[model samples]
Target chain A: MSDQQQYLIIASHLREAIQSGELQPGDKLPSEARLSQQFMSSRGTVRHALEKLRAEGLISSHQGRRSQVLLPALTQDFDSVVSFSQRCQEAGKTPGERIHSREMIDAGPRLAVQLQCSSSASVLALVRVRLMDNTPTMVERIYFPEEIASHLSDYQSSSGSMYQHLVERGVEISHAHSTVTATAADADEAQALGVAPNSPLFVVNQCVYTADGQPVWCSEQHYLPELASFSINNVKERPSPSFFTPGRA
Target chain B: MSDQQQYLIIASHLREAIQSGELQPGDKLPSEARLSQQFMSSRGTVRHALEKLRAEGLISSHQGRRSQVLLPALTQDFDSVVSFSQRCQEAGKTPGERIHSREMIDAGPRLAVQLQCSSSASVLALVRVRLMDNTPTMVERIYFPEEIASHLSDYQSSSGSMYQHLVERGVEISHAHSTVTATAADADEAQALGVAPNSPLFVVNQCVYTADGQPVWCSEQHYLPELASFSINNVKERPSPSFFTPGRA
Candidate 1:
């Protein structure tokens, strides 16, 4: 094998060991001489493999001490709009959804302004708990305008992707505006998410618009922090001002 | 005044009241008749002003019920990269930094890989407590390579903007990659941030890179969630995938 490919292979092997818990957080990695001997590679190749892992923030190394493992954090892309199910599938985890409630109600003042409709307009509200590997991860509460609500009477079976459902129905999905905040879960949220009351939760409020800038749906998702996080890449071309700001559509 | 100008002025008045804590969270707003009488405006104008506040996520309203105020959250834009001091100044808050430690050390395994240097290379590490209005909000630990470290010995006086300082030194910062996760505060982190042991904290790990793709610095910032949150706008054009996947330069 090429010298470059050998380091990649060694890195992947060590990465799998870390992921499988064979190498745990704070556990010291084997010495470079030992790793080189075990992998039948040169010291330089072993160091290159270890450097790859370090660059990924998986292990910490000191000058004279062996590298130590770090707890792996689950990361979610904050720049793209993807369904929970798609995200789970990509991570090789089973995704499930349990419908909690689905009902049609008059658009109250808050919903009216968000939907840009009259206060009396009828809207459909769907609340469901999103699960990863049968563990409750997030509770999503979504509201759809009457036009889209008319098509999904049996939403319980169709709880997977509302964005896809809307797109199939000729509603062109465009961009989304999302706000992420941390909050302590209230009793209702705590029970729904299967966490202690007042546990830290990552709350994401998002509004999805259509191609013509018409608001299609607004959702509030409460996520258990242990199971989820977000990542972003800030390019100099479009500098981000602050970590949290009211984004204009 | 024009009708549009009247509603905006009333909305700003209520917004200022909320900001100043004259109206507390969960406190009911005055009746429309009372507000119209107080402001000497028409009932329609009062309702329009309330709607504006509602759209801003400041207050909640229901049919035939008084609106309730909401707790204001400090939001940071995740897309734009700005200094904490700059962000505070933009929000009309004073920013301060307390240096905890600034020392030169050998590049350990983690630092070596992150800085793309040998373990024998010397790097400068700086730890500081970030404050907003004299209240501790975050603890930042940053590491710089020898090129930058050689020039910055008195970081305490130069703590205003590390990016700006680097820019003034002829370092062209291109972009940064950041990962946001929730973690329980350890003893040192807890004490520095003035939070209880094991309190939930927002941890952001970021690596800034130069224009030519050279890694400049790596930072780990632990934020008090009560004082900070993150915001992002996801457009359809750039679809981000696998947040933890090793990002290519």
Candidate 2:
């Protein structure tokens, strides 16, 4: 094969390795000399394959260090309220959930306000550790009104998606307004996720509402920044640059 | 005032404190007993107020631990292709850049393919240390067609926005597609960003395209996850529980 076609083949094979998670994120690939030997190509040809992977966001390399394999594509529909399970499956991975705690509790001040009721109301607090490929990915805490999740206490939430369970019970969760923030994981969370305390985590706070606009659930999802990513699609222009005012162009 | 009104007032105050960064992310709030004593209210009322802030993604609490302030919002527009400087300005802050290195280099095989050009084509490589609020935020490495950024060699890029420069030059940057991943910082990057080596950083590899679909630039932006966030809207349609198809309802 010609040099160009040979490099393309090498690049394609490497890209598949990355997408398949066979070469996990942060796992370094062989050096140029090694890749050249392994692929039976010249040093120049091996470098070309690496460069293409880097350009496509599939790998990252440094001047003196070896290139590291990246995670599967984190890009997803940002405007659609998709579940963690759905996202993982879309990426061809098995998404699992481990119930950390599930119990009915007194509605606290925030849950009460979001549920549009008094603090004395009963609520179901569901806490779970979500996983992808057995790697702890997120710690989610969800609160639903007892009137809504009344049967949650007895539900088997281990094998399937919680939203699916809710939908089956007639909870029409249509959309959510979410706020995302960055924070240093505290000792507890970092320990739980097997990372150092103070490691960064993306915290997503979401308030789900029904089609009729009634708030149903207030949930907090904290993701290990390395395991997942969120995406958004925009057809119209982005919010005008900050310099443009209402009266100005 | 009624009990709910009093709690709401306290919640609002706490929310403002968190938003202003006076109570920073991970800072512990006053104990429930202390808050009630300080505010001259019942413990139930203080608890109620704290709960409201928690529900709004402003704070978090453990069963036995004091509630910690949630991280401040660090959001990126998912739809529009805007520069980091523009985003900072939108948040009402000055964005700054320190050019670390700039040089003209030969485009390699992979880049040549991505740019749809010859491998020996000349390119301008730009690396800048981006800062916000007097702290290092991100390291952006941009590669451009030499002809496009030729004048930038003499340009004092300090505190300047590249997007603004491109616009001034009549370049219409319509959109970009980016792949996001999470990885540990290396020795050089860790030292530059003042974070520990191997600390987690959000790596965004982006290929920016013009209105006519030409690749204008390719960049790799590494952000200190603790210092920034990328936010996107997700939709909810209750996809089926099948592990193979995540988005199909």
CAPRI-style quality class for the chain A–B interface of candidate 2: incorrect
Model 1, residue A157: distance off in Å is 2.9
Question: Where does candidate 1 chain A have its weakest 10-residue lDDT segment?
Answer: A240-249
Q: Estimate the Cα RMSD of every predicted model relative to the unseen true structure.
A: 18.0, 19.9
Q: Score the docking of each candidate (DockQ).
A: 0.15, 0.07
Model 1 global lDDT (CA atoms, 0 to 1): 0.68
Model 2 chain A: weakest 10-residue lDDT segment is: A240-249
lDDT of 1 by residue, B56-91 (tens): 445654548887764342223322354677666676
TM-score of each: 0.61, 0.58
Residue-level lDDT of model 1, residues A1-249, one tens digit each, is: 744568778987997797688987557889999999999998767876775565344565344668766434222333224467666766687778888888899999999987778999999998888887788888899998898787666443433666656666777665556666666677888898877776777667777765344678999887887777776545453223224521212
Query: What's model 1's TM-score?
Result: 0.61
Interface RMSD of each: 11.8, 13.7
DockQ of 2: 0.07
